[model samples]
Target chain A: MNPKPDKKIPALYGGIIMGLISAIPFVNIINCLCCTGILLGGFLAVMFYKNNFTPGTPPFTAGDCLAVGALAGIVGAVVDTVLSLMFLAIFGDVTQQYILDLIRNMDIQVPEEFYELFEEAMRQEMAGFAIIMNFFFALILDVLFGLLGGLIGYSVFKPKGQQPLQPSPPPFMPQAS
Target chain B: MLLRFFSPTFLIDTVVMKASFPYIVLVCLAFIWCIAPVLPPMLAWHVSPANPLSSQLYTWFSHICHQVDSRSLHLFGMKLSVCARCSGIYVGFFLGVVLSPFLSRRVSLSAIKWWALALLPMLIDIALDVLGIHSSTIVTRVATGVVFGVNAAFILTPLIEESLEKFIPMNWGQRKQGVFYESQTR
Candidate 1:
């Protein structure tokens, strides 16, 4: 059997899905539910990997899922950061305006100082330090959550009717005669 | 008296403790995770010098949560590191972990369905707010979050435990491969 298919393709597929969901404005709200979008990406990666298995291949294991999930997470984090930068370049911080409008519509009474701090932070969001920090944190969270998703995927997608290989019976021997 | 050390009871006790090491570690990590969010607000309120640390935590959590001020619970005049919904989830998760010992250890694939069912309330709450059918209050968010979290803890903990049992012993390089695989098969 072909050595369990290369993980890169599955990881890339999962990463792209994660990045798009996370970077898109409005669509990203799904992540607010415990980073569900990222988790879904990891789960999909494992699912894709499981599809690669064929008869006589090494049986799927939890470790394989974990490694693929983590790789996808790393790729996802990079994709997310790049796409976020692209969006900022094109839309010019629309997310900041969106938040401000949301707060106003909700009639929340935030302090004047808070507004100043928020605006200041938004302005600095494009800076090198902030971008690096964001990537760093995103990487950590994505990897952790992705690992969890992989484990869940394993539980759900484990192969059926696959039993452990029993040891061969002791060789037949004739009694001394 | 020395023979007592080799007794079945003593041997079983030793094996059990070794097996439980990973579970204990997981519980400790969960406790830390649950408590981390509370520290930011408490530190901001009580220790002026710790403001930087508190700010760091808020920043760290910001990625995972929206952290809308009005939607969050306030402690010591400062908003929590995460929103009330997230807070409820964490608290509920901790409670679930603590209580999981009393729950059934046999978690089947069907537990996933129950976990999904638990998320229904939260989804409905979000959908209502988004559709302008009804504005979800803080109580609704927290309540739904708690339900989801508890179910998540129940479903995921056993899976994690089972996986760890399969792998952790291998890391120690002690158990024979045939014996290990045989145990897993059983």
Candidate 2:
């Protein structure tokens, strides 16, 4: 695009939205919709980009979409990690209790060792912050889904049939014997 | 006309099969493989309650899903690999893949926005129930999830097509014609 829209602000806004939606309890179910909520953040970023950048200048390319999406993804990862950890800190034990209850209902015979392992793992995850797991999940899911959302946004936002410079074929000439 | 969409070639090759052939192949296979866990989990549960496959499915999906029994659909007298809403989303994604070809490959945000719209009722149902606004049902969850998932397919199929174009400039014919020539990734 000929004009510049400060890209970072919109992307950060979008990423934050994605992260909060993905991290929140109950609301996080929206990710069940094939990460629709997360991708929407990326889509929103592109929408902001389009609105700010003059339309039809260079046209928003897929590359632009990916960049915006990626920025949103990175921001989303940070947000998701912090929020998930915080939420886990507050409700982690309760959530685990619910899981235990469900296991009893299911009547599955889990060895005592597994529960011990799970508890130990959880404690470690909480204590160590498990930034690696959170960051990895966020990075993969955010970038991929965000890129998709950007593409959808592109389809919706991009002006249609506006290829202003189609090369014309040579004029037809009659052949002489 | 629609039959062509279901033909073996269509299933095998996909929309614009010849364009960005490699990316399409890779993405489709990867997605299929990723979502393939649902069935195995059920089978494992049937075979042995604590079967490895079933346990593994639970362990992995637990990160992504709530996996509460009440919220999940039961098959073979056992809980599914994931919650009901989640199951609906996955199944709906399959349907979306089926329907994508019939839909316009239009690059319209409106086309993509429907997925969010689809989720409104589900979100409302949950909020209402949680807040004691009203009670929500499992059906509500699954139905809303399906709507979101199906719409997602509409967005995704096109994205895959677009991504391929962006990544690989050459069409199938061009690649085939120049097969023996010095090739470059770009």
Candidate 3:
């Protein structure tokens, strides 16, 4: 009766959660943990669905894990971008001021020309256009990294006895059967 | 009143030592030690008015750091041990973990296939750069680095998880021992 297959809802939720986490300041390196979070979340969702919906049956497959991974990666990327921006906006000026002050206190002998160039660059960077421009580039890098992480998460933390078999079965399996 | 909430959080932190230790190790090895050792020689080589080791240091760093002029911190003069993209990835990894519980919990490293899609972008970029069809820009270098870095995390996370899981008492120990014993007996 429940043959209409779908893991979309859980996948989306899992993805969003993962994405938001990836956006966090320090904890995001758990991305170093790669898709571990997404896979775990997807597994949690499917397990929850199974436990709550049906008593003792596991309805997980490698493909399900893969799907969850993709979703989480996307969500994580989006969250990370927003978080970086929020942090940048909040702290960027303060950080710049501190750095400039520290340099001055140390009495570092910076050449006049390079100092001018550096100040100009910083000013441009802080300007509306430059920050936005860098953000766009950063977004691309982030998404690709997140996606790769998600895919790897699927590979590593896939549920026991569940994962899309990357290598196809040999041609003669039917004959043996 | 004080004991009510603080105890549980304290206990949770105490129990999560395994989870936190690696990061502590990473902080020491990846950032603290890493930044100091490579920087001095690099700086002395690059910007100083009269420096003897500049050429040697530049050549040495060339193998390790992409050393593209733009994404570098120009002090007395000379790029850091790594390029901007490489630095970004490492620095990102180093700095992006302040909210580990909320952020770490949201994503799982295992759900990703980091290495699977990497071949094409890596190959095309490196080959083209070598062939000189187009110059390797900072953006392109970063793109490649991100791909590789993500893939690296995929490989590393499982090793960490497996190690962590081992600290907990799970019934699989008997089974693991049995398999090992059987193989040795055979």
Top-scoring candidate (TM-score) = 1
Q: Which regions of candidate 3 deviate over 4 angstroms?
A: A1-67, A94-108, A112-119, A125-128, A163-177, B1-186
For candidate 1, write residues A4-53 as lDDT tens digits.
Answer: 78888988888888888888877878887678889998889999988888
Model 2 alpha-carbon drift over 4 Å, by segment: A1-6, A20-37, A83-122, A160-177, B1-23, B26-34, B39-57, B74-78, B103-144, B170-186
Arranged by TM-score, best first: 1, 2, 3
Model 1, B72-123: lDDT tens digits are 9888888888898998888877776655554534334354576678789998
Q: Superposing every Cα of model 2 onto the true structure, what RMSD results?
A: 8.2
Give me the candidate number with maximum DockQ: 1
**A61 in model 3: Cα distance from truth in Å?**
4.9
Top-lDDT structure, candidate number: 1
lDDT of 2 by residue, B68-124 (tens): 788888777667667888787777766765555554343344543565675676788
Interface C-alpha root-mean-square deviation of candidate 2: 10.8
Q: What is the C-alpha RMSD of each candidate to the true structure, in Å?
A: 9.6, 8.2, 20.2
Q: Identify the CAPRI category of the predicted complex in candidate 3.
A: incorrect
True contacts kept of 1: 0.19
Worst 10 residues of 3 chain A by lDDT: A166-175
Q: Provide the TM-score, chain A, model 2.
A: 0.75
